[model samples]
Target: MATLLYGPQHDPIHIEDRALAHLKIVIATKLRRNETFTLSWKHPEAEPGGRSTIWIHPSIPLRFVFDEPEAPQINVRWVEELMHTANSSGGIMLVDEVLDIGEIERQH
Candidate 1:
């Protein structure tokens, strides 16, 4: 598990570590470009039965904490999918990663 600590209030939004890793890349890229967007995700089974969305801005304080000692291998295709939605008016929607078999083959 990983926690996304957003803003000064430090409201903790829990997410799976793998998802968080991909999100971190997309979020950082947008913020670096001075772009703002919203991130939406459904609540995990452990949390209440609802979805949550947050406005991500360049100036806001954001942090990603992972329980794993090392970062997981990133999925470029997943990041591209996220970047596509991040640019949309509806903003980024958190979705499960679609394994890229081609990418894995290229890596090996």
Candidate 2:
């Protein structure tokens, strides 16, 4: 399954091999321009809080291995689902769902 890190803004960021690479470039560009972004991920089955969110600056190094498992697919339907959940939170809530990264790339 592909691992995806969502933002507090409810924006779904799909990351894969080349997509991850492209994202790194985009992140670098944004950081170079002094932009900041918030990112979140699940804590895995062993964790207590269930999930965690962090504000990622431009300095974080991102690396993806081709041999790693592919991420799950993320589609409009998934976005709708997330929106539904986010809206119900009363306040803005961020979530990270595993997505098939290839799906996003294929659609493009």
lDDT of 1 at 49: 98
Q: TM-score for model 1?
A: 0.91
lDDT of 2 by residue, 9-49 (tens): 44433334433433444445556777666444444454455
Residue 101 lDDT (model 2): 78
The candidate scoring highest on lDDT is: 1
- Taking all chains together, each candidate's TM-score versus the true structure is 0.91, 0.34
- In model 1, which runs have C-alpha deviations exceeding 4 angstroms? 101-108
State the displacement of the C-alpha of residue 41, model 1, in Å, after optimal TM-score superposition: 0.5
Model 1 lDDT tens row, 38-73: 999999999989999999998899999999989998
All candidates: CA RMSD (Å): 2.4, 9.8
